[model samples]
Target chain A: MTLLKAWQMPIILGMVLLLALFLPQMQLNLYVQMVLMYVGINIILTASLNLVNGYLGEFSVGHAAFMAIGAYASSILTVLILPRRWGPAEALRVVPLIGPELANGVYLVPAVLVGGAIAAVAGLVLAFPSFKTRGDYLAIVTLAFNMIVKSLLENSGDIGGLVARLIAPLSASLSADVLRLSDAVGGPRGLLGMSKLTSLFWVCLWVIVSLFAMRNFIFSNFGRGVVSIREDETAAGLVSVNTCQVKVLTFVISSFFAGVAGGLFAHVLQFINPRSFTILKSTDILVMVYLGGIGSLMGSILGAAVFTILLEVLREVIPLVGLSEVWRWVVGPLLLVTLMIFRPRGIMGLREFKGFLPKEEEVKPQAAPAPP
Target chain B: MPQPVTTLVQQTLNALQVGSVYALIALGYTMVYGILTMINFAHGDIFMVSTYLGFFAAAWLLGLALNMPPLVIFLSTLLFAMVGTATLAVIIERVAYKPLRQAPRLSAVITALGVGIFLENFTLAVIGPEPRTIPPLFPLVNLNLSGVFVSTIQIVIIGVSVIVMIILDTIVRRTMTGMAMRAISFDKTIVPLMGVPVDRIISATFALGSAIAAVGGILYGMAYQLDPYMGIRIGWWAFISAVVGGIGNIRGAFVGGFILGFVEIFTPVFLPSSTYRDFVAFSLLLLLLVFRPTGILGRPIVQKV
Candidate 1:
């Protein structure tokens, strides 16, 4: 029993890794696999959003903006920047290492991280305004940020040309490449024909990494400062929490994870558009965050899973019950309303599931000295 | 070539027409926020529902084939939409918002968003996705004044909006109910102790706000296409207008609405395409928020340590 308890985390992680490696190969129904893929992406989105909204107590209604940034950045890399002749699957087919089929998955990590890094930088947009604004004003700032990002992409067609023209004086040949790259974004129509690089193993691996990263961050000293700021900003600052730094770092970290999810999402659909990351999409993330419970990591996982599955089930069941698919949209919000009315703090509220609790939190209890 | 004065005047008129509708809708947002301090995310959808109400009312009135005067048809449709939308807003307040009054503010905001989605999708499900418009109740007359053309519809829309604004301003500034509202907004806990019917006042706020949005809806439907999802974008714009002018402030909403109207109308003139309209509007909002966090007219919130 002692040995099992000691190895609990690794055992569970090993099991998840094993499952991810074989799940796609099981030949599950195509639609089922796609739904599972969405479930994974949404879980990542919910977890990252929870860091800012749940733990930090800031209402960011524009997480999708960061997701869009990540999506566009990674998609541009894979589809436009990478040499056409060096397609991952073809180049790695001869290498018998990590299985030729799975070798292509190697490129996806860096590409997605690059997307995330760019999105983390974009996080400054919200972080700076947050210094002064709070509540609804901050919410509006996030909403405006979402709109600005979407419109920026939508107008990228003209923007690209303008940039190219501006650069024409510097170097004619480089300007041509800049214009071509911008055209590849596909404007309002959306970027398409991305190589299907996202696999179950990669998604599972990233999900584990993100969940672990978020879990540790929340338990760290900085995370304590984040929660303190949420509870009472002035008090936190009085206590030497460095409230500004904590808030900015929290936003960036949250944005980074959201971007990572976006990268995976782009490759999953093998297409992306600005419209895909609208306020409505952000609202969907918000719904999941609230539904799961604020300030609870486990709640995010449960909320994302339940919300995604419920919608998928409704999509199937509504048509079977003599209602059109459009009714699912109506039913979805109706369910959310009922949920809100019943459980105002959400399912988990501020508590965590037993399995998700840190080892010391669950095991040591009264015997352990409280950290100062 | 330099821009002609006629083109500038034509655009200014267009801005006024759009601004009137935005100002009307922004009033609803500002009022509700003033009383409750909650963003009524569904207000835009209420505006949407009002337009549909106007559409059906106009359709039914014309279908009667009574040969009623055009003026009568327009008035009845407008009245029907206003009453119906007001009732809807009151019901939403009682059912969705009232229970969450003691809950966290974010919960109320989230519920408002859910209500918004429900309203939008409910409309989509029942009405289908095809966009609709109210048939013209009165004949339109385009009057050309020295190369600048103005339509009678534009005149009516601008005229009615200004009249409504004056009436609403008078009510909030002068009437007992408006005094109660302002008192409650100042201190909700103290006002009820002073004999204000808090719930009724809140419901009244929602009704008044929704009614004003209905007027804007009817006016907007007369000039533009109406769809269920129309509320989301327009609502956000009006919400921005409210924030830009300083939320919870009435006159500020008016000013912010016109600013957004000018942005929308003039964006295409300066930028390559109208696609940059949202970009410009949102950037303006960001800049304004950074410099004037409380908005143009909003008093800065003093943090109490």
Candidate 2:
């Protein structure tokens, strides 16, 4: 049953992709396309976050840390490897160690995958501590990880200096250039001068991939184990599920995708700063997950799309309506509180589209048995 | 030797002052966690909002319009800020949290995040994009206690914090409401069966927590000046303190705050580089969680079947 539902989503996704491809032409506006691109990135972010918060039942508030890792890693690679050209041949030559022929077509995808993998490694650092603590402790550990990442990035100059000193003997001839390259990482000032490689196609494609992967993970046997652990860890353990393994896996997978989303965002904005990835960003993702309904994959996608649009709309409409910027904060929380109070299960809860759709018999109504 | 001693004394006093503020904020976190088992992420933002409130009241309303004496103006502003923040806390509990009482803990956590964002952005909009100066209420006077030099404001902050802690401890131990709060924490379902008003107790808890947070906010504003983003860093520290001390343990929160404060202040001094302060503090927090999840003073909460 789940597989059939999963198969159906890709078809819908393909249709959406086709529609998005023609949207710019239809609307004749570049700004709208930019907004659409942003929405796609957010879709990737909120969907992947659902894997941890919704499917795994772990509260992770440091997702942006992974995002930062991915952003920096991918940005560094792209800046160093990719030639500053839009032509097919130049793009091909820039691909790392690949023959010029295949590089142009496949290099971007590989870069994104590598970025995600790097973030997954970062996730391990955060997940190791989770073996001992759960709930609020886990939340604090993750929060600390976020702050630590930010601080480290802000203080990357000191790290660079130490590395330079260590390698001074080996690279005496090229020490100055190496130091300059290290400074390119830009410490607290932030990473600048990166090419904007994130386009609508890449963003939308990743969003689809993330949505599909999260949905499959949630419905699979492993997904059931995650839910079981969430419902009752002891009971799940007694029933033979390795609760710890499930948690660690879920966290890593979620972190990997968050990293991918971050890379996409960094490329889209063409800038990377430590301040950009803070607890506030994590909170935004969390809000999307909860507002959509915990454990509901489709709901998360919808929630992210709605929220990104709403934020933009609010920014545009609020000032026109004579509401101050302070009012924006007021409205966001007010809406969230109202949603929690009235629809705590979110818009979908654990139920899915199939569950909501009326049965064939109900749709037809059996004609009331001809007034029997 | 004398110079080192003076430095040590100054650092110690600084640690105490900062630690007291953290303890005040952590109380709100610990108290709420004790009952609801939900981390009120917005508590830190509430602290931020209170500082702004105090700032506006002091600089704009009292300082500019009323032309009152600095001491009287400061006291009145502080009082108003506390009341305003307390009301905000109660409203948050009523609006954002009360509905999620029976819902999953995750939902409440998310709502708390939402509330926090709301408070932050609201302050940003109202306060503009600049950090405002808070007029000094008390004179910056220092005292030499033996070889240690401590500022008058620091001493006052520490003294008031201790008094507040003692008063809260007494109320929790010696009052009917405190018993009711403890009862609810243990088994919320049985509280109503025992004929207690659970809602009232929870509101009181929020009110009490918010009041303490307001004091912390005002003091923090006096110390560091006022800004919307000030709450973000301090809030994280306070949250860390609550967790390090054991989330639901009040006294543990106090101890955790002081420990964190000392770690933050002393790490920089000893390392001769302030850059690694966050690294050391965060690493310590993670290690503590791994070794003693319940913290120094916190007892483990037993999970029910």
Candidate 3:
């Protein structure tokens, strides 16, 4: 047991290094490399959402909004402020004397962290409203927040234009090119010329870190308090768990990681739009959290990897049936519907793998709780 | 820009027409939520299926047209869509929700969402993804009532919705099945002890809700093109309306639908462009929910100790 605790992080780190540093340099196709990066990103996303949905048992259907915020926040940074030699960010590159590759690498950590910080703040703002909203009402509020963010992004051109006009006179130096004001979000055409700063290395690093963080949190006293609250909020309050503080703190951390994942997504795709972060995207992440068995860190990791690979496999299956890419979408929902019917608790269904996680973790009474 | 008075009246009429469709669809959501305390996210897709049913019925009727009136053809399409969609709803409830009745609420919600995605994709795969325009049921006739020009289509939409709601209200209030439904919603265990067949009543609820939504789908089809994914956006709005009206309260759905309709239609007027319509509409939803979580017409139950 001591050996497992002592060496797990090192072993996982070594594997991540191998995959990120060595795998890319090896004889692998670009498609495979991209899928691997996405798997890493999904791992981060699923784990973060698992904190709220799995651990806290809050029905937040608007997680993608946080991701959207992170994406735009980081994308705008990379586009408008990062080193110019990379891409669209060149126009506003105030610094010099750094090599192009080294500059890109150096710029990524802060940009992504900034994204996480911004999203975490948004989560903090939402925490108060969430205290008043319970059950399905909370779900609707989150979903609305998501739509509000998406629609705002979609109309970002006009809104940006309005703001530019309002602020341009005050600050004479803030030119259109300086602000990249002409087409910051591209107004539904999506923003382009993003610095593809997302490396397999960064993704893998974050995924490992997030997993370790989540696992540790799950095993902590604070996590036990969160779980008790999920099991029964009123009961937990009676035991003096300070459920509200736990909920807000968990939400802030979860959304912060979600933002980090979104930063990865933007840099990898080299572009982003409002369309990419819809309620559907949130639903996709939710499916992973639920499928893996909520509150199980390892399950979230497993679910992300499996779901990502399943998507890739479905892509391969489409051409074999003499159909195009859209058919893959059809197959996915069909599979999900069937899977839910047979295994509503999800593929993991609260059954955690042993050793690191106890075997019989999540499989406690499947019956609905008594009416509140 | 159009004249203020003219635009005001026109938008109000338009809101009414749109609100009627929302009311019809919201009823389905409220009804299902009342009985099961589950959202039945696929309720929107069931409405989508009804549109296709309307399409095929119209095309089939065209082949046998013996100088039949347009109104007659429209009536048949409504009938076909209602029956077909109601059956689909029953199958969905039986397969997706029935087994998970005792599971955690999240499980049921996920199942419903999966079912909705399944229904949407299945239709898209079968019929191809291009939006199909349904043939206009009748020629558009504009009537100017005190400088307000309301089209026949608008009148028909509002007219049909009211009639259906009346029938539904009567069934819920004045029938044996309705009593069983109410009893089940209140206390399923005791109702079963009272010898009421709970399963059948639930199925009947599905049938009724789905049928009303089908009528909504047909009206929506007459105004807009038919697409498989149309249910998703529209379904969300109706769900919001249901919640805004107080989810379990039938009357709440109707009132909430109109309120949402006015907000959605009018927000674009005050805003710079219609792009933020959803943003504004949903913000309004959040505001309303903040003040009154149970909705305007919904009753709150005291938490059991």
Candidate 4:
């Protein structure tokens, strides 16, 4: 017990590292591996949403918009930038310096990072709207943003044509290339045929990094500013918190991780579509955030894990009860409603697991001056 | 080609019909938001469910084979849907919303979302994803005035919506229950001290909002096929209408709904396809929020320190 209290973080992290590195190589069922990957992706999503919704106390229902941006940004890079014949061996042979197995893995890192960077830029743009609004009004802005993104993606094909025709009168070659690239995105039909590069190790690594980043941010001065904004925005500004800067920074950081998760999600599915990133998908992330608890890192982790596992379990168990697969969707919402009614604050609320956190320094007793 | 004036008049007629349906649903959204300052996200789903209720009721009436008049069947089906939907809304308020009145505001919003999702999926599970429509309550007739053609259904939809709006406006302006609701919206804490039954008034608000939505459902079902997921898209559009017109303002919602209807129909005329409808509508909403956050008819909210 004493040893664990002293070195719990290192020990637990080591175990996770070992599991991530070896789990894919083990002879585990493919289904179980997929579920684990989903768990990791969902954890990243839940944590990012928590930063905005839970900590900042903003109700953003359009988080999937950023995810869609990240997914498309990364997918376009991996599919278009890479050579036509995409294989680890081919990549390694082309690069020649890196090992065959690690070649694509190394390339994926930059692609995902680029995706996050672009999503952060998008977040920066979105954060400006938050400056002028709060609460449900802010929610409307996010919702409109989501719809606009989806519709824009759906209309990409037409946009390309319109742009090409307009430019055709000016420059012929540029118009052709623009049209080709627009069609390549697949528009409403969806982008397809991306290689499955999202391995268990990479997913687990990203999940751990996201968790650590969120925890560090929450403990930092800016994080306190975020919480204070949630508690009372006027008061926080009165105290010279530079609330606008903090809010924008928080939005960018939160959306950056959400984008990273989107890249991972795209690779796992090996396909990308505007339909995948809708209001419904955002609601799924919100459910996970609220399920475990709000304003708690441990809660986000647990919430993501439990919600994902429960979904899988219901998918399997519903069939046994003589119900169709669609019943799972019905059951999921019912559970959420029940949870809200019974425990409005969620499982963890604002509390963190004591064991997971380092001990606070014990206050030493000073010599009392006889009932002074 | 037809005269441009003919096309304009024809489109305007179409827009008015669509706008009236949207106005009905937006009124529901604005009413709930006005009374509780909470977005009843489930209101859209309630609208969807009411359409289904109307569908089943019409189907059953036609199956009775009683040689009844179409107007009687329509009115009875409308009444059935209103009562049923109002009951559901009142029950939802009591069971789901009442307990969380004192909790964080977002909790109620989230719960409303959950309830909306549950309603959609439950309807899907029971009715099996197949879209259904209410049987025609009256015979279809086309009316030609000058060069433009209009249908009897369009006139009925527009006329019924206007009548409902006038009735609702009068109720809010003159009735005791409406007065209590307006008072509560002004100051929730003190209204009960003045002998208003806050809980019952709230339930009445939910019931009234839901009843109005039922009217929209029946009209919409007559015009288009009904599906469980139909609520999501139309509900969002109606919600946007309410927001654009100024949430909690009845007249604003009416105008906003018509504006949305015009946007929906006119986008296809100017743009290459109808797909740009959502893009135009949302852009309009975003622009409005940026310029006038209070909405057209809504009073500005004062931030208390």
| The best candidate in terms of TM-score | 1
Query: Model 4 Cα displacement at B252 (Å)?
Result: 1.0
Interface-residue RMSD per candidate? Answer: 0.9, 2.0, 1.5, 1.0
Q: For residues B91-201, what per-residue lDDT tens digits would candidate 2 score against the true structure?
A: 989988888888887788888888887787777876676977666776778788777877778977898889989999988888999999889888988788989999999
Candidate 4 displacement at residue A43 in angstroms: 1.1
lDDT for each residue of candidate 3 in A218-290, tens digit (9 for 90 to 100): 7778988888878899899899999889988889999999999988899999888889999999988988887
Candidate 2 chain A worst ten-residue window by lDDT: A356-365
Q: State the fnat of model 4.
A: 0.77
lDDT of 2 by residue, A182-279 (tens): 68778778887665566676777788778767767777789889999888888999999988888888889998998898888877888988889877
Q: Evaluated with DockQ, which candidate comes out highest?
A: 1
lDDT of 3 at A83: 51
Stretches of candidate 4 exceeding 4 Å from the true structure: A1-6, A84-90, A93-101, A167-174, A355-372
Instruction: Sort candidate 2 into its docking category.
Output: medium
* C-alpha RMSD values across all candidates: 2.0, 4.8, 4.9, 2.6
Candidate 4: TM-score of chain A is 0.91
> For model 2, which pairs clash?
A326-B125
CA shift of A342, model 3, Å:
1.8
Question: TM per model?
Answer: 0.97, 0.89, 0.92, 0.95
Per-residue lDDT for A275-309 in model 4, tens only?
99889898888888888888888899898999899
Model 4 residue A24 distance off true place after TM-score fit, in angstroms: 1.5
- The DockQ-based CAPRI class assigned to model 3 is medium
> Judged by lDDT relative to the true structure, which candidate is superior, 2 or 4?
4
Ranking of candidates on TM-score, top first: 1, 4, 3, 2
Give the winner by TM-score: 1 or 3. 1
The sequence of per-residue lDDT tens digits that candidate 3 reaches over residues B101-155 is: 7777788888788788878888888888899866788997899877788899899
